[model samples]
Target: MTVRTTARWALLGALALVVTACGGTSGSGGAAAASERQVQVSATFAQGGGGPAYTYDTALVPAGATVEVTSAAADGGTTTTLRVSGLQPNRTYGAHAHTKPCTPAAGADAGPHYQFRPDPVSPSVDPAFANPQNEIWLDVTTDASGAGEATSTVPWTFPPDRRAASVVLHEKATATHAGHAGTAGARPACVTVGF
Candidate 1:
């Protein structure tokens, strides 16, 4: 993928547009003051299959476009919003809060969706523990300008010792049946976050 960063001004302008369009800001002050705790991460998808079986690359999220993930505290409620931007226009992408950080290390790659009570097995396909209520799932559909946002909320908060460390973008919507219910598709990019 063509991994790189756009100018800071571009980001500021985009953020301004995001706040206004989404009505996420209040008065002169904005989204910065509307939450309790939050984690935001930015990353660029690596071109080609880096790992995780498949990579969306240019075919889905587009190379080099910024991938952002924001996880916020429930704010005395059962809700955590996850947002993404700088993606391919008019396409849907599935994303989840991961148990590990995004890395190229052979053994430390984003490991599984962060489950409230981890499924005893890997690649958890079980509907009971892999459902949206047990894990954070943000499936986003971008606009004409390759910017979008999605939110996910659960009744519980991340365990202090082991919280979601990353957010991985995928090629498809989260499934709802016999297959991996939370598995979006081949992970294309991940945003390393701390929550």
Candidate 2:
């Protein structure tokens, strides 16, 4: 064969080797491994139309405060974890998945908590429907340095019609009282998350 033919053969051989080195795109009949979906949102507390919106006190959700929500589903169950940073130190804050996106106007714009079962009310006050088992309650108490994490694993996934849209940070831990069950005082900041 000519030198040109030999070079063409060599190039073809190298291509084959490269293809072998990299795993083929097609699967091997078995179900492909599931991939974890992570949604990251940065929180901000700024003065609203009235005044400082995020916090009732002088404390502010420090700059660079962020919320990270990660979800993985397998074996007929799903686990969701949320981590937050740069909040008020040594304070517990009520957090929940909301149904609306975070806008600059006010925390109210973020809408209500993303309840798995439709509460049939704007703000769910009943403990039966507003408990952590039914809602995403990621209430966290910051350390001295202002960081915390919470996790919730459920047998079901989020609502298909309306997924979690944002995470709202409240000023207090959620309550369990009747007709006041999911009350977390004063939403100071909201982080827009996509799931």
Q: Which candidate tops lDDT?
A: 2
RMSD of 2: 5.6
Tell me the number of clashing residue pairs for each predicted model.
Answer: 1, 1
lDDT agreement with native, every candidate = 0.70, 0.71
Q: Stretches of candidate 1 above 4 Å error?
A: 1-36, 42-56, 74-78, 104-108
Itemize residue pairs with steric clashes in candidate 2: 54-188
**Model 2, 54-131: lDDT tens per residue?**
432336565446556666655555566767777778889888878887776677788988877778876799988898
Candidate 1 structure quality by residue, lDDT tens digits, 29-110: 4544544576665555555444222234556655567665556675443355555556777888888888887765421378
Identify the leading candidate in terms of TM-score.
Answer: 2
Off by over 4 Å in 2: 1-38, 41-58
Clashing pairs in 1: 1-47
TM-score of each: 0.68, 0.72
How far does residue 48 in candidate 2 sit from its true spot (Å)?
A: 8.4
